[model samples]
Target: MNAAIHEFTAERLAGGDQSIGAYAGKVLLIVNTASNCGFTPQYEGLEALYQRYRERGLEVLGFPCNQFGSQEPGEADEIASFCQKNYGVSFPMFAKIEVNGDDTHPLYRYLKKAAPGLLGSESIKWNFTKFLVNRQGEVTARYASATSPEAIAGDIEKLL
Candidate 1:
């Protein structure tokens, strides 16, 4: 079997190492985010999903990325502050990481490989791209940047 997402580790925006394994057995909505993107407002919908389904095993993880248009050019503190103040985001947010190119974060590298995008492309096209993983750590689906969090609610419900 392929490696589970729980096998990866990333730094928390608040400044500490975090093992993805800590979220094992939880349904995950892993998203690449940016502060100034056109889709930035989706944070509200994401938070709504987290609030609505967290008790049912859903865990939304946000990873700030500046690889696209330099939209998330803030330091970890600024990024965390923006998310909380603007969208009241309480879901876990990770430190800035690349979602594409040479320095792509290892977690993202695994996600893209497991759920390649349109035309089987492994590279992420834009920020807010999401990967939904089931409790077993299997990547069940990949959602494009345009896919709203609300639209993924049913899928998450099924997993739960």
Candidate 2:
């Protein structure tokens, strides 16, 4: 399902399945999150980005993942509460998904293909790896976990 971001469907943490098409015509920041990863603190900067640019047309989509060292083992409710209570995360988060390997989610497969990481590697190295998508739903940039959310602010601002 490479390059399938335009056609992938995700089951929302809130309840049902929805198409990535729903986010068409908007800039999207997609991240793989883990509750216990060292970079988990990025959730705050992500939330800040969301709050600051959403009205101007930015949507940050967080996908909890346990594939990276079982860092995000919480159930749906627990995950939601952690994000809300700690980071005040108000953006949409989907069900936990595998970002790489044979079971990789369709959306992630699309992203990994569009904007590969360091040295053009398709595998996700760690938690908080991000993909930035433009209004046309084209994957534009990719940021590694160590690349903080604040660092990507300019790119997002450019898209807006």
**Considering every candidate listed, which one attains the maximal lDDT?**
1
Assess each prediction's global lDDT (C-alpha) against the native. 0.94, 0.91
Quote the positional error of residue 100 for candidate 2 in Å. 1.2
Model 2: residues with Cα > 4 Å off, grouped in runs: 1-4
What is the per-residue lDDT of model 1 for residues 85-137, given as tens digits with 9 covering 90 to 100?
Answer: 99999999999999889999999999999999999999999999999999999
Q: Per-residue CA lDDT of candidate 2, range 34-95, in tens?
A: 99989999999999999999999999999999998999999888999999998899999999
The positional error of residue 11 in candidate 2, measured at the CA in angstroms, is 0.7
* Number of colliding residue pairs in model 1: 0
Q: Can you give the TM-score per candidate against the true fold?
A: 0.97, 0.95
Question: Pairing residues by index, what is the TM-score of model 2?
Answer: 0.95
